[model samples]
Target: MADDRFSMGLFDARIKDQRHQVFKVLGMYFVLMTVAIWGLLSLFWGSTYQLESYFPSVKVYVYDFDSVATPNAVLGPAVVRYLQSTLSSPVHLGIIVRDPAGKTFDDVASEIVGEKAWGAVVINANATSNFEAAMAGTGGLLDGQWAPKGAISLVVAGARWYQVVLEYLLPYLGMYVETPVLEASHQASASFLSTATPATLGELTSAQQAALGTPFAYQEVDLRPILPGQWAGAAPLEAGLIYYIIFAFHIALFFFFSRLPLQGMTKKHGIKIRWIHVCLLRIVPVLFAYFILSLAYTLINKAFLLPTDGNGYASFGPQAGFMVLWMLDWIALASLGLAMEAMLTLLTLKFFPLFLITWILSNITSSFFPATLAPKIFRYGYMMPFWHCTTATKHIMWGTRNRLGLNFGVLLGWCGVSLVTICLFELMWRRIEERKERQESAKDVEGQGAHK
Candidate 1:
């Protein structure tokens, strides 16, 4: 009895052996987790590191409608020449010189609204004519109003990408587009004033003289303006994405624990259930859970009074828009939750947190930044669920391009992939468990025979 007690004591050889085994296990865990964390950080941080290098990928059309025959196509041609020169500069863009032959300003605006181009600098058809007339003191000018601003239309769809537009595109336009155009107008006006007869000089009114000072101002037409109230919509696109995955993961965890009692009843209380029924039991409840969770999630946006009327983009009324948003949230939740559920079977609880970090990082990195401004690798974000969901959310909230069909299709495709993988993984895990149980029972039988 003394020897047996000694074997179980703190100094026992068995205890010493187990300590080495524990250390070895911890060492391996630490090394692998460190590698995983570093790898994930690299992926997350790499996306935006050289974003400025890819600035030229953002296409901005420069349509020179004013370059046609007029007394002097000075302002329009000067603006286009200055903008084209910037293509070779350090901070350049995809400044495509669009043929303004048959394309009207409306056509250019449509291209922007349809997302064919990030933005446009339309030297309006009347740009030179209007400015020349204003300079000649013969054009229509309202009281204290500037006409050159209306001469050039700078078309941008803010809802296309609020952050990208605000941060990069708008500033780029201000620098490369607005600045050059203003300079050209001022120079043109100065040259005209230098050669003007006393009659032309005296004809200039105070408002017209002010307009001549800045002869070519751009009228910034944001087809889909991101209103102040709509700033709350960023939640779903940015930080809220992490919360979405966390919520889905918790739902998976809750149901996993909930199923344990049923599993115990089958094992300990001699209760029986088919494996297919078990799979259904796990999947169906989570789907319903996402449905409820998504509605509650959407209601938070609604409660905060985020616009649901598509901000003048879509035809959906307030109530219909709310329902659309709810449905979008439901599908987005299902896409995120189902994928987590599928991965949980293969990764299990021990290793799932690593996968969780990878999932969140991958989705967040791809969705948060515009792919055109990032490396080509991030263009894969176009297919990611978070990207599509973010795009659809913008469409629903701020009225960006209405690609609802494609967004929904991609999200549902992710759901389909998750569903198939869940079934396969569930079946695989079940087979593994059954095989372990069979091996355990065989060992027991062999031990009993040896005892006899």
Candidate 2:
């Protein structure tokens, strides 16, 4: 029987062949992982100083007509202050009024927008009270959202920081709109809308309490103790989805290329590992291995030279589980990669095709840089697994626990599909193996007959 003890012993012994290659593979893997981890650590380590260098510094030039020069001075500072109040102040960005060669506001916008400028805000004459009106009213003239009654050009860069400025732009355009995240919750306006509104100063007062209904509402989106930390502070659901896809591919590649070639970890004497069994076997091994990797990653990120702050105990188990579940997807990738390797192994190809595919996809996916930063056309491409894993790892390190559940779900899907694929491949191989055995036996019988 295939289950005979002596046969099993020989089968087990076959694994030793793989042992010869382990140290070499491990050395290569260690070098690569170490370089990557160190480079990442260096960036975050330097972020403290690098963050200060910019200090909200994006020099946005605002060229306006002389008529609005007085309003510009007042409006500029007010815009800067509003920005300061709303944003997390990592950058020092503001509008600077300059009339180079006495060019008109339109002239400046035309020149700058074409030269790859970030954004532009042109204030109309008598637009000073617009900010004041906005602080007091909802929106209409200088006191409303969009165009600010007389604003000329307020085009967004349509790139990385669009969301950051989309809602806030109206507040600065004519100082008329107030779109605060917390305006709906807790309902605390600046506690005072306009400190300089004529109506408030000239008419409304505490002494005339009966006439005044209530002051304007002010609110700010303050997520203090930002739960997931800086690395995982983004929209969790979307981010988690992305990371799940990326890591699925990475682990799958590692499994197919690295783990399988190690020999005994994969090969099993004459047993035809159907695609299903192949997939199942891989899933079991990798789930154990990968989760451990996740744990190792977490420990290093937390307790090492540079620790990523997060809820360690709560985070470690869930993130590791999520990371392991990704093997389903890894199985799919591993299937494709292994197929290529299998072809090379049998046919002696000059190079492994899967490596190129993995490398290319890895570059585009699981990148540390944001996919949204990619050109609008390419943004969706980044949603694939390669990018997702990078983001997911960051999420895990940042203690974003809720997303761990979501990642686990997505990864499970990949595992199921991969298991099916492996079973199919194994069945095909079994037939081939059986046929070869028959051919060899027939040749042996023919040789006996010739001797007779």
Candidate 3:
């Protein structure tokens, strides 16, 4: 009876001590969480506002082929002048003028493709002749021979946001180039018709000038359109929501498992199971929660459920292919969360700091802009799991036939690597526990020997 009372007293004391430790850790967790919330809000909002004051610099290579002959000067110089004038204030242009007399369109386009420049402008050789043809209303057929040709061709890197900015500015730039060309065309036509009737020429010239204010013609081709449709067509926020949703679920699951009680499987029931098995078992319940939440969210949104056309240009749909992709993505998320929780088990209190680091890094990821344009450190953010999830989700929803395979490869790779890491961590933890148990047994044996 006395031995039983002693063992009961010791068990009660141990339980009390454990309870105390749990309360202490919980208190610290609450305090840290409060601080983290405040700090995250301030940091995220502050950086966004600060980044607004600066404009990304774009480099444009301009090759002018317009002949500077008399009667009508080349419009190549006029195109450059207009580009320089309008593509400013919001976008800084680094215009590199190549001698049109020597360089061909292929050379400049190749250079832009090589990343030597963001975009290129090639003005054809017959700009002067074409302007004269327009003035004469000859439909580019002057003196019985068609004018050699005059057109501006733009070749730009399509994936970068800064390059897109330059492309958008082109139409506005037509305002500058078109006004001067029309004025010159009007003067030439009025002069040619003056001998017939001055009053009639004046009226015709005024009317024609007003109607043909914008006569310059240009064509643009993006080197990396990636899809059939314009990259600009995808809303940045809609695409970014993929990252946000996965991130929320990943972090939440990480915390859930970190604080979960393992007594039932570990000791109370005396079940014989490996830690890896426990980790794998978690997926069943997690998948249930994920499916329920995802279904509810999808229903509420309705936008995601709409069938996509999957047109040659832009893919649109919520079809079976998308469902399979989403399922794989969910599995990857589960593996990611489990791996993080398992790895951090030994350093439980550090989860908050690690979470903060991940949150900040993800916020700075190049979602709306070109990854190459971001800071050197932020360029590495592409490797973050959330970034891959965002890319895959966006491509599945709206992108053309590009990068879907790569995205799937990356996600599945992360899952395998993370699971392997967790197994290694489990082995290490088991070894540590075994050593401690052996030492405690030795201590107990020695104490009993002394008592005997």
Candidate 2 lDDT score at position 82: 48
Question: Which residue ranges in model 2 land beyond 4 Å of their true spot?
Answer: 1-281, 304-353, 356-360, 363-383, 391-407, 447-452
Ranking by lDDT: 1, 3, 2
Candidate 3 deviant stretches above 4 angstroms: 1-73, 81-91, 94-130, 140-200, 203-207, 211-262, 269-272, 283-311, 314-346, 349-357, 392-401
Query: How does candidate 2 fare on TM-score?
Result: 0.37
The C-alpha lDDT values of all candidates are 0.83, 0.41, 0.53
Query: Which pairs clash in the backbone of model 1?
Result: none
TM-score per prediction, in order, is 0.92, 0.37, 0.62
Q: On residues 1-452, what C-alpha lDDT tens digit does candidate 1 reach at each position?
A: 45764456656685798888888989988998899879888877888887788888999998887777464677778888888898888868889998888887778878998899999988877776766666666764656476667777778998788778878887888777666776777777777878989987787788778776777777788888978776777887789878999999899898889888878978897555876886788689999999998999999999878888887668797799899889998999999989999888889988877778888888988787888887778788889888999988888888788889999999999999998899899888878988998999999999999999
The candidate 2 region of ten consecutive residues with least summed lDDT is 215-224
Instruction: Rank the candidate models, highest TM-score first.
Output: 1, 3, 2
lDDT of 1: 0.83
CA displacement after TM-score superposition, residue 269 of candidate 3 (Å): 4.8
